[model samples]
Target chain A: MMKVVKRTYMGLIFLFLYAPIAVLIAFSFNSSKSRSQWGGFTFDWYLDMIGDRQIREALTFTIVIALLSTLISTLAGTVSAIGIHYMGRGVRTAVLNVNNLPVLNPDIITGVALMTLFISSGLPLGAVAMLIAHVVFSTPYVILSVLPKLRQMNRYTAEAAMDLGATPAMALRKVILPEISPGIISGALMAFTMSIDDFVISFFTAGTDATNLSILIYSMAKRGVKPSINALSTVMFVTVVILLFIINRKSEKGEELML
Target chain B: MRMLAWPYVAWMGLFVIIPLVLVLLYSFTSGDIHDMTTWRFTLDNFARFNEPIYIKVMADSFLLAVASTLICLVLGYPVAMIIARADLRYRNLLLMFFLVPIWMNFLLRTYAWMSLLSPNGLINRLLLSVGLPKLEIMPGQGAVLLGMVYNFLPFMVLPIYSVLSKIDRHLLEAASDLGANRFLTFWKVIFPLSIPGVISGITMVFMPAVSTFVISALLGGGKTPLIGDLIEQQFMSDRNWHFGSSLSIILMAVILLSMAVMSRIDANQPVEGRRAA
Candidate 1:
């Protein structure tokens, strides 16, 4: 009886969570444009979504900005994590507190602050501004992700490599880099996710000419129902599920090997 | 390595520090952002915010955020407990269900709710089919609150689940061994230990709920305007940077004040638990 109750409770919560998504996926294939009624299945929405130029541009911008920000932040964050790891306690603490500002503050504050900065500084609020904003918010996350691995690392590994006649630069390249590669990869993944998933910050910074997928969605959502958005959601949801499944499988295998 | 950090430090200073300073500067001065000569130091922006309508928005934002956080706690706690106590093989799978929705774009997720709750949308259709009255919740505080809970439920559950799962089994055993019933064991042993997670979860849910314009904008149907909407308007439409900056400052103060209170509560918990034990 207790087990049954627990299962039912879990089922209800999952239902609440998935009901909207299920409705969305179902509506994407509906031949009817009305949201409330389904009039047989069709693939027209998917085709329409693909044919839409604005959505295509938004998708392109989303992926490109995500890629660029992830690359820049990962490189800068990994280096800074190394630097921060070697800093004196006082400076490290202060820098870390500063780093947490973007992470801790509300997204709107960060968005508005950056928007204020760009406007005041005479910087054009477009793709470049959006890229800069993405990097600013994402780099701290990478630093946070990489810093843990740096702490876990054996401090003397690089020094030992140096003692064996390796130059400081060579030791860093061969020893420290490889040791923290996992952190770097995960940090890069995080930065990419953050950049891609961002809406509030992007909304403020993207300006008139640059609209990412999220900005496009927000505007469309506000204007009322769009069947194309439902289609887009289905595609993105499926893609995310597949990616997460692969990641989960790989991580499970890693655990098995460790065991 | 220290030298390697300079570039990032410069970036942060330029992007993070300077922007915030600019906001602070704007909050205190009325000006054209492009031209410095027109800038005049004044408290008029904040004084404008002293109006009753602005205060009501702040109060409503606070109330709605608190309500959402409370709802999340009530609904999420059991979900967390169940997941934590689940068999090891299923734990990750169950947790993944919670995370997948979050990984979906937040706006899309809220938009999903909009379709479900709209007057002519799925829920009303279902209700009509069932010979029931239509449930009209969209474009209102109810919808906004629902959106907040739906979106933030995972934030509440994940933290509590992590804390609950890490709790020492031996402690529960000892509680049961000491003439305590299952309920008492949970109350005395498990609940107290999970307070930190609860505090963090509350902070996580409340902060975003209070500051989000998207959920309220999309789900609230322009009827329910939170402080976020006001801030967005000030910046995006009103083009009143001074008033916006002042609103942002107040929002920051509210968040910081709440966090300080939460941390104080968190700090005091262990001692109280020890005494009770």
Candidate 2:
């Protein structure tokens, strides 16, 4: 009886949280202009999304930028995490602070700072700048995600490997990598999601020729909200929600949670 | 090792550190919009920002952020507590609902909110159909506050849950055995001990609330401009880098000052000094 009541309460809380989003998605296919009528389900909006040139370009650009940024940041972050492990207490703390500064800083401030850096670096404000800025901001997340797990892994394992005459590369590739594989995978995903979902930072860095999905959506909303945006958002939301569930399920099977 | 470290240090200094220093310097300088790059040292921008508009906006941002933070606290604390107390079998499900939203595209989230809150959208339509007065939600500060709270709630919850879940249940049982009721024991024992989680939640929510731009822009509808919108306009449309830099300097000052205050509060919190209080 107690468990049933608590479960019902949990259901209600989730309903409150998700009802608005669920309703919006349902209303997208409504035949009327107003959101009142639930006329019928139709594929018109989803069909339109595939044909729309702006969304196609924006979605492609956003994914490409996210992928590149995640790849680079994972490399830098893993290295930084490794280096941080070897440092003394004060130095390690300072480096960790510098790494985590991006998390505490405001999006708008980072955006402006990146813009300044690009202009000063004489790099044109476009895809390259966005990629660089995304990596710079996201590397800290990758570091935080992976480092504690690295610390948790038995240090003796690595020392034993070194004593067995393995090179740093060999030990990292063979022994350390397998132990912290979970962290690396999750860190990569975190960086990927963060880069892909970001609008503010990408907006500041991408001057032209590189508009991301968020920018496209924002511009369309500025003009006016449309049923098509609702359609696109519904699809995106479902994809992410399902993906998150799958990831969590795998971790529950003793794979390890996203670090 | 030093050589390897040199590259990263140089990279961070040139891009992150130097520009912030430049922002401070530029805030003290005066120049025309036409030639903002070439600065003449003066305190004019800071002086001009002493106008009521900038001052009021900063205060409004604080009020809005604080209100949302408080709501997140009330709403999130119960949820975090329940999750912490839940069986391991059910805890992950609760956590997923709280966290999966953070993974979805934020633009999509904002756009979804825009549709819900628009004039002809579900909220107003529902009101009209039910014979209730249509609430004007789009133009006001309330909508932005709601949007910020919704988007940032997980940030608040995660930190609190992280602390709460690790707490030993025996502590609660000991308090209960002493003849304390659930609510009273929570007040006397649980709440006091969870100060660390509370402070962590505060910083997690407060920092993001003060700086978020998309929700403010999407929900604010280009009117009732916050410092975020103003800074964006200065950098892009206004093309006045010096003034923009000055605004950034002031904004950074506000954030750093708040963090300082939060740290002090965290230090003097009851859990830190008196163990059994």
Candidate 3:
């Protein structure tokens, strides 16, 4: 009786989890784009997505920003994590807590405040402003992800490298980086996905012509619900699933790389 | 690591502190953009509190956030339990389900809902065809809550899942052997152990929902202006930074107070996990 109840509960939970995405995937493929009559199965939307010029551009921009933001923020967050990881536990915790302030603060605060600062400083909202805002948002997450690994690692290995006459930089490069590489990679992935996924903050910070995929989607929505966006969604959805599959497989292989 | 210290100091100062100080200053000083730098610190920005509308919006935003948090917690708890306790084979896929939506572009997900829920959209159309009541759901408070809940569900899930993975199964077995039934065993053994996750998830949902702009803007159909929407409009369109700053300051106070209350509750409960204590 208990087993039955537990199974039913778990089934309901899975249903809740997958229902929306299932609905989305189904609708994207539905032949009747007018409403969702399911007239027939059609791959026409996915084919149309291939030629959607604005969507292509938006995706290109989104990927570019994601990569750029991830790379820079990874560099910064890794540095911060290593720095705090080495500090006395008390001081490290304090600095780490302060670094997490951005997460606790609302995005409106971050968005409007950053926009105000940049505009006030006469800094045009271009690549620089958007990248800065992305980095700001991404850094804390990377730190949060990596800091646990830093905390858990046996530090004596790095100490041994240092005592064996390697410089601190060399020890980090030769030993520490290899050990913590998984955390760093996952952190970078988190940063990349998050930057691309970001909408509100990016919309506020981005100006004139420098819109990411998210903003492009919003702009499209404001204009009208184009059936083409369904095509675009189908494309993005497919790519995301493929990407998730690849990442999981890679992680499974433990493809550890330094830098 | 020592070398890293300098750059972090530089990074935090340039990006975090200066921007934060500027916002703080804006909150205190006069509101007009023309005299932004000059200060005759006035409470007038905060004085806008006399209007009941602003307060109403704040309360509504808070209520929506709280309700969403509650729903996510109740729903996420069991899903997280299964993900944590499942056979190792499908664990990755189940976890991927949680991560995929979160990692997917937020605008796409929100807009996808727009298409799904619109008056002439798929959902409404389906209901009409099935001879059910043709319900309007794409606009207003209901729509905003839907978007907020959809977007926020993962935030609640991730934290709870992380916590669940660390819970000891032996504890549950022990509770059952002590003569507690399955429900009582779960209630006494599992629930208390996961309070930290619940607290963190609450913070995650409440913080974002309290200030969600894009979801509210897209789904509210201009019927409601959330605190986030109001602050955003005040700064950009209204060009009333003074008023915006004051609103921001008040909102910040509310957020801090909410967090304080959450932490106090967390502290009051005797922590079951070593780390939580």
Candidate 4:
């Protein structure tokens, strides 16, 4: 009886989570334009998604921005994590607190603050502003991901490399880098996911010309979503599931990495 | 290694510190966008909250956030406990199930609810087929609350599960050995240990729910605007940056205060769950 109860509860929760997704996936093949009626199955929405120019542009921008921000933030965050690891306690504490601001603050505050900053600095709000906002928000998570690894490893490993007649850069590249590579990779993936999924910040920072898929979706949602959106989400959902499956498979400590 | 830290320092200063300071500056200033040169500092933006409408929205935001957090706690605790106690082979798969929806675009997820709850939506159709009335819940607070719970329940569950799974089995055994019933063991031994996870979960859910503009916009249909929508409207539609910044500052302060409280609870007893990221 207890086992049955548990199974039923789990089933219901899983249904709650997936029903929307199933609806989305099912609707992607929806032959009818109206959401209410399933006018037989058709691949037209998928084909239409392929042919939609605006969606294609938004898709390109989304991937490009996600890639760029992830690359930049990962490098900055990992390097900083190393640097902070070696810092005197006082300065390191202050810097870490500063780093925590974006992570801790609500996304709207971060979005609005960055938007205000972009305006004050006279930077035109567009892809560049959006990219900078992504980097600012993302780098902290990367730092956090890398910091624990740095704290766990022996501080002497990199120094040992230096003592063994290797140059500082060589020591870092071969020794320190390899040690924290898992953190770096997870951090990069996290940053990429965040950038791709971001909407509030992107909405504020992205100006007229340089909008991503999220911004595009928001606008389309406001004006009644196109069936193409269902197609788009279906593709995105599949992509993310595959990516997460691979990541989970690769990492034994997947739960902590996710945290 | 120490020298390598300078770029990070510089980046944080330029990007993180200065932008927040800019928000502070803007919150205290007044003027049109074009006439930034003559901007004068004033407390009027902060004072604007005295208006009944803004106060109502702010209260509504908190109310909704609290309600959703409570609901998530009620709903997620059992699920988390069940998953934690489940056989090891199925644990990862169960966790993965909860996580996959979060990976989908948040907007898309909310949009999914929109389709389900619309008058002509699937749920309504089901209701009509069952000889019941169509649900008018879509464009109301109930729908918004549902959306909030759906989106953030994972945030609540994951932390609690992480902590619960790590609970010392010996303690539970001891409680049962001491003649405590199953409920008593849970209450005395298990529940106390899960407080940290619960605290973090509350923070995770409440923080996002209180500040979400998208969910309220889509699910609430602009009929019920949360503090987030007010902030968004001020900046985006109304072009009132001063007011927006002030509201942002207020929201930030409230969220930070709650976090401080969580940290205090966490400090009193060191938590095994994920810390605030």
- Write one digit per residue (lDDT tens) for candidate 2, span B1-277: 2233445555666656765666666667766633557768887787777899888877877788899999889878877888888878778877887676666677667667777787877788889989999877786687898888887788777877887787667878998998899898888777877777888898888877887667788887866677787788888788777778888878878888888987897778765423532
Q: What is the Cα-based lDDT of residue A167 in candidate 2?
A: 88
Best by DockQ: 1
lDDT of 4 at A117: 81
Local accuracy of candidate 4 as per-residue lDDT tens digits, A1-259: 9999999999999999999999989989989988777899999989999999999999999999999999999999998999999999999999999999889888899898888888878899999999999999999999999999998888887889889899999988998888889899999989998999999999989978888988888888778999999999999999989988887777647655776
Sort the candidates on DockQ, descending order: 1, 4, 3, 2
Q: Which tens-of-lDDT digit does each residue in B1-277 have in candidate 1?
A: 7988989988999999999998898899998866778999999989986789988898899999999999999999999999999987788899898788887889899998988898999999889999999988888999999999999999899899988998878888888888899899988788998998899899999999999999999988878689999999999999989889999999999999999999999888878553433
TM-score of each: 0.98, 0.92, 0.90, 0.95
Identify the candidate with maximal TM-score.
1
TM-score computed on alpha carbons, candidate 1: 0.98
Instruction: Please list the residue runs of candidate 1 whose C-alpha ends up more than 4 Å from where it truly belongs after superposition.
Output: A256-259, B271-277
Off by over 4 Å in 2: A1-12, A33-39, A88-90, A153-159, A255-259, B1-5, B32-37, B270-277
Clashing residue pairs in candidate 3 are: B31-B242
| Higher-ranked by lDDT: 3 or 4 | 4
Error of 3 at A123 (Å): 0.7
What fraction of the real A-B contacts shows up in model 4? 0.87
Writing each residue's lDDT as its tens digit, candidate 1 over A108-134 gives 999999999998888999999999999
TM-score order of candidates, best first? 1, 4, 2, 3
Worst 10-residue stretch by lDDT in candidate 4 chain B?
Answer: B268-277
